[model samples]
Target: MTGTIYSLIPPLIMIILVLLTRKVTLSLGVGIIIGALFIHEFNVMDSIQQIWSAFYGIFVAEGGPNMGTFYLLFFLIFLGMLTAFMSASGGTRAFGEWAITKIQTKKGAQLLPFFLGIIIFIDDYFNSLAIGQVARPLTDRHKISRAKLAYLIDSTSAPVAVLSPISSWGAFIIGTIGAIIAEHNLSNFQPLESFVRMIPMNIYAIIAIFLVFLVVIFKLNLGAMRKHEQRAEETGELVDPNRNDIPGELKEEFVQTNSGRIYHLTIPIVVLIISTIAAMVITGRNNVEENATLLTIFENTNVNLSLFIGGLIAVYHSAIFYLIQMQPKTSTFLVLREGIKSMLPAIYILILAWVIGTIIENLGTGDYLALVVERSQLSPSYLPVIVFIVCGIMAFATGTSWGTFGIMLPIVGQIAVNSDVNMLLASLAAVLAGSVFGDHCSPISDTSILSSTGAGSNHIDHVLTQIPYAVIAAIITIIGYVVLGITGMVWITLILSLVLLFATALILNKLTQS
Candidate 1:
């Protein structure tokens, strides 16, 4: 079979395996086995050689296979632990206690998770774990389901990252997009500014974020979510409010604790947000965090370090000083250890994901795809939509957004220069939309796994549940891109797509209910 055939086989097999078993690691491992088989001429000796060669290619790319997720996994794990620490230390409970105090109505309660998600865009990893940990109690207080909160947090994670320039996510995204300009040799191409402007035009991201807000504000109905809103309206407890009486630091503090104390929950989170911005400035990332030339304290700091620092500070200030009970105990240290330990499985998966990406690169999969794209000489007008779908497919297959970008950026540059493509915007749109799309729905995606695990939903449950919503949004985005190219009305495409998405989500919600 051809390289293209081989390239796609892995992801398809992986997807089928996931749909069957709902196990991400198992699916990915199976995907790897298929990939090795295809490349190795279906011989055992050849398969081993192909896998080894594939692994070798990862190191040559200046981004080793593990390079993509090493830092991210580290940040996510510790970030989880920090959230656990805060929860265990009474910090999260303290915040929840306070948030529930102001809520005389169910409406305010639903809106709180939305608010928390919006604020946490400072860092997606921070946003994911932090919001999940902090808001769980508040949502629980308001009769919110874990699924609802997970949806809010997951929805917020990417949209905020999509919009915010100063985030851990921006670096990879901005980097890939900028490469298009360099590859196309576009004269006077302003990489950073171009990327910023394209965000509004990136329809899937803009719409998904908007849909979440609508869900909260207008109460646009969604699956199993209506039950939650009704319950909260009646009683300020979860749908199944009876505590299982599980003993430990996690108790019903939201109803018991005062509202003034609830605002304390917002403090470390607020500081983390402020500090994140401050860190960008402090570190010299400038306001446009990804491609900035600014220099300072964080100039040399990797994103994971920044996450750790921000998390430490958020826990110390928000939980330690403000939410303290009795006295600071040694258990806080234990929680950190436990949190780090919790991340070990994810860490291993990250390494394997990278390794597979490396193997794929060894087969020259990305380069081959780039070559195919370049030689096809696709029209500039369709580039944005094409890029979005193509990159989405690649990411869906590989389960690594960075790997998808790594392969696509240079190739996109080649196309932009060779053709009329707005290399910067088109490339930017492709990488951002593709990465987010992949992470949003891919079974093997690390973020997807964590979101499900953290929210207590089965991994496949999350994937199966979310795919319809994600696909609908993607369809709207395609229309948005086409309209953008024809009319040159960027904002029109942006706002209209958001509207369409909300309507579609509403429809999906109604469908899911039926």
Candidate 2:
């Protein structure tokens, strides 16, 4: 009943179950039930009612955070429609044929996803799915592993979003920091300034992104990734043998429609990108000062609404394109149906992840952990590293970086103030970086799950292949925080960390090859 050791049980149960059974949905569902039971004094009926209420509350509640969930769900559906239409129109096939001429090498194929991921930094969810859908055909043609493609998708989504000043991720962080400042009456604090200053100190994101380039450039395949890549290269088996379906198999019904023109693919995607950016700017204009920069507009934008509008426009554009080409209206509609259906599994997982995140919040897990840190006798200089490790662990266990941020930001803010931690920016960056690092590793993470779905790889396979790379980044990030904590020199810490990461990548390459 108390926020003590009992608070840890739900996440521990979820993590243990996921690892053992490899059933992310069941694990999260059971974890939520356990948390409900704890909150309801072990009364099974009461716990069941509480669980139902929580699920219901996500939709009907006024001013609920679940609006973001709704936005993401619609985004997925429309994205599915877009992909379906592209495949049925022969856009993906035509694009693949075109791409192979320019990107003939395996390294170029791998790098394409990396580049696409970086360019689509508006939202992580959109980034993961769009990059996966667009780049899969190219990667497959060159015999690249789906696992590596998923890693590229997952790594770029969160890392790039968090680092970009004009992104949904940045807006969320700013809002969180703003709330902390207002609640605590921190008169001297400036959320935007602090957020901008902390960007470079987000070492995990930087390193994770850097590692993607290294892996693609140097062909550094370690652990299960190496096996997958070797299998793909030697046998042209892009999909893992253990998986029941091939990557991008869901689009097979539409592949026969190949129009033999790259424009079939490029047009819809261009429409999607341009419309989304325009929506963001127009929607956010009212909230900004005169002559506001793009970053300011993004910070003020209703990202959920912008994404919804953009998605609908993209769907309409694709549908119209097909109709103009003399395709039957029914055929276009069929693509819509098939696309939405393909995304249903991912949508289900996303809902469950949200519910589990709600349960963790109710259980006071983050508060209890923060209290433990408050009571600790650790030195002030170690706060950044400690916070980084704890945030990483919390995010890994909970599978929601936003949830982790909501829980940890206030606690870290207080710690920075009370402990006189001169490295507040470094500490803030640690929380952001660590949350992303843990999310990258967690099987139940929405981004991780979606990355797998996007790349048509097994969910667990993506997690297994990505862990070594994430860990490498996490280790280096921890070292960066430690150096900043000790020296309070941001530039020096950054230089040393970059060198360390590059060196570590070289070592990994040598060791993996050996």
Candidate 3:
């Protein structure tokens, strides 16, 4: 079953189940078990062992704990606590009160996260959760839907991070591109230059960013998102009332200070941003060789550790503020407990997602998809779009863009080298673009889940509402890739793609309104 069409069954079943039942945890659990069974040829003992090993691997690998996963999970927990403390301290209410005077419009509330998402492009994980904490109050005050807020965060985080040279995503991609160049013996290819060049060719990311602003500025809510928006506008219900397990939602009642100020919220976030960046730089510096440049430092930075440090500091800071402001009877222990409790649902979903992702990888789902792409002897002109679609499918199924990049980049490199050297960058850009598009649509994707957690939206609601917008951008990206493949003109293709995207968005907005 490994590295064959049989490997596709588990993910396909999982996806179908999620869409039909909207039960993420159950669906993911079933997928994990089924994948394990398939990998072990239905041998009960071996399957059980495989499942255990995969589950164990999330926290333990080799001889030590998996710090990356641990750090991220802790970050989420701390972020939740931070949010709870901020709210309990009246920071959120104060921020909302302040925003009402400053923003004064629903459009401005929607735009806050959009712009913040772009401005904070160091890492998608940080951007997704942090933006939610900062902007949720404003969006809620203005009656903006949580689904829309999730879309804004999801749309901006990856697109901006993927494009920025200093970001974690960019550093990884550049390093990967360098290895591919060395392996293929493409001496003329400069990794940094190639990455910069591919930025414009990443039609999906660029167009996704544009689509977010267009949707916000033009009020282009479509499909399920329209329903979410309508509900928020009419009833002031930011989230779907039916969903009881929304993560990052502080349901526990706590006392708020009459003297709540915007600075209470802003200070902790600022501390987080500054401290995280400082940790990244410090960690990067420690790991780098003596003549390391800023880019190399970022490439070697401990992003998870940095995030953990930042979240820890922010939580501590918020707690101090909360303690000073809260009523005498409000126990600190309960606030912390409630904050942890609020994040448990997200944590479970994440762990399940990791386990299922591991099972699918063990089943060689990505390998099967990569094999299909490798076997296709398509024209060079079709390679960009073909790779785009394949990479998208792989990421969507696996629910991990970085995983898809690891599996597909090498294959894309080899395929582009053998087929047409001219299309290498275009094909490479397609991998990044398509992976993000697929991640945007995948219900199991970490960014999507985090985006939902961040915006306090129902996870399934975020996925359902965001898919239509992602698909539209992807369709436009396909056309853009086709033009890039045929013309080999980055500037022309990018310009035309943006034009088409704006025109499509405008037409759709007008039509949807009618």
What is candidate 1's lDDT per residue for 174-266, written digit by digit as tens?
Answer: 655566666656667665677688778767777777777766665554444555456545765442344221111232222222223444456
Query: What digit string (tens of lDDT, one per residue) describes model 3 on residues 1-514?
Result: 8889989898999889999998888888988889999999999999999999988999998889999999999999999889888887888899999888999999998888988988999999989999999899999989999999999999999999999999889999999999999999999899999999899999999999999999988899999998999999999988888889898888867666676778889999999999999999889889997998889888999999999999999999998898776456367787888888889889999999998889989899898999999998899998999999999999999999999999899899999999889999999999999999999989889999999999988888899999999999999999999998888898999999999988998898889879
Tens digits of per-residue lDDT, candidate 2, 308-332, equal: 8888898887766666665433465
Candidate 3 whole-model C-alpha lDDT, 0 to 1: 0.91
Q: Estimate the overall C-alpha local distance difference test score of candidate 2.
A: 0.81
List per-candidate RMSD values in Å.
5.8, 2.6, 1.1
- Candidate 2 regions exceeding 4 Å error are 63-67, 178-189, 245-251, 287-293, 326-330
- In model 2, what is the error at residue 8, expressed in angstroms? 1.6
Best-first order by TM-score: 3, 2, 1
- Pitting candidate 2 against candidate 3, the one with the higher TM-score is 3
Output the number of the lDDT-best candidate.
3
Off by over 4 Å in 1: 42-77, 104-107, 171-185, 218-301, 312-352, 363-369, 421-428, 453-457, 502-514
Which candidate do you rate higher for TM-score, 1 or 2?
2
Kindly report which residue stretches of model 3 are placed more than 4 angstroms away from their true locations once superposed.
326-329
Model 2 clashing residue pairs (backbone): 90-258
- Whichever of 1 and 2 has more lDDT, that candidate is 2
